[model samples]
Target: METVEDVTRMRLVGGNLALDFINTRTGPAAGPPDDDLLTGYPALIAWGVHAGALTRAEAARLRRLSRDDPGRADTTFARALSTRDDLDEVFRSLAAGGSPTAPALARLRDHEADALAHARLQPGNPFAWTWREDHTLARPLRPVVHAAVQLLTTAALDRIKGCEGCSFIFNDESKNRSRRWCSMDDCGTTEKIRRYVAARRTRARQ
Candidate 1:
């Protein structure tokens, strides 16, 4: 059974993945003094799922793979995740500052292709519409979903950054550079409290 911390960490990873693919730095802040977005492939996938860019079945398959065989998930995510190193090389090779073709890009392209293929395979499948008004709506909204994923991925890759403490990706535009954790209200506060308590303990001992 995965703990809450594990799930949170995975969520951060997934977000970072989207950030890397889009080459954007417009996600949640990382910590104080450096407001960087977390990056990871799983986080990207999660974003897609939440944004209605990916089918529930596809998301379920990924989650299952992640839980049952973490190695498989890691391999898939590693291939799917993009990085600054990739963009730097890609942009340098492009005529109009476009992205270049590399192993990582190839992997992302492959995943996109695979997703499209899967979407096509279930053109009329009822399971595709998990949140639809009508469960039987076989609308074949794959094109729209793909477009959303593409746009989001592009945005994330362009605006996302990695967190120093955790390998997450988020947008970093805080004035004080004190935006640590995926959510300041969640991990950030908890960490602050822990640190404060530790400091108090140290003072009492002294």
Candidate 2:
């Protein structure tokens, strides 16, 4: 079972809420992810807090509510996992220079509708969508859905890319759009070492 420690240690290299959510599972290429951090409802809450999707206070309240209702929490956790998979499929397709399947898009549209239905418009210089303050078990999902909707319907769509070293999808915000790895500390460093070792082996053989 995943713990708060695991959630805290997760690297948020996606640079977007939806992408971060998708990255809960890591180390995938042609097969299933090797690590899935969201083990249960509590882990979900921890991730929400870690990912800045929920405030500590909000996470506390949700934790209390989940403790009082385990069945509902289980359901919410399952739904969240399913939504994450759908998002992975959709965005991975986009990053591969293809359109998302209709079914996946429809599932995402449903999640977006749910998020919007619970949101209110905030009046400002530029009016923005804000989530309603509720103690609902699914509240953590609201921000993630909103981010996904924005990415899908806006210019950010073109900025999404799959990391060359991992299965994580990130919003490439570089000026030259040359980002290839998820992070320099992890995949990038590993790839560099791998290349250096290969070069040394070739030099020795020659």
Itemize residue pairs with steric clashes in candidate 2: none
Per-residue lDDT over 10-58 for candidate 2, one digit per residue giving the tens place of the 0 to 100 score: 9998888999999989885546788888898888888988998888999
Q: Please give, for residues 1-206, the per-residue lDDT of candidate 1 as tens digits.
A: 32222323333322333333233233233322222222444564454454445567766555655677667556545544333334323332331235556674664455455446544333464434232222211111233334434544565333333443343445544555445465665556777898999999999999
Residue ranges of candidate 1 with Cα displaced over 4 Å: 2-49, 54-101, 113-159, 163-167, 173-178
Give, for candidate 2, the lowest lDDT window spanning 10 residues. Answer: 26-35
Quantify all predictions' global Cα lDDT against the true fold: 0.43, 0.88
Quick one: RMSD of model 2? 1.4
Residue 155 accuracy (lDDT) in model 2:
56
- For model 1, give the 10-residue run with minimal summed lDDT: 131-140
Q: What is the number of residue pairs that collide in model 1?
A: 42
Error of 2 at 72 (Å): 0.6
Q: Would you estimate the TM-scores of all the predictions? A: 0.37, 0.95
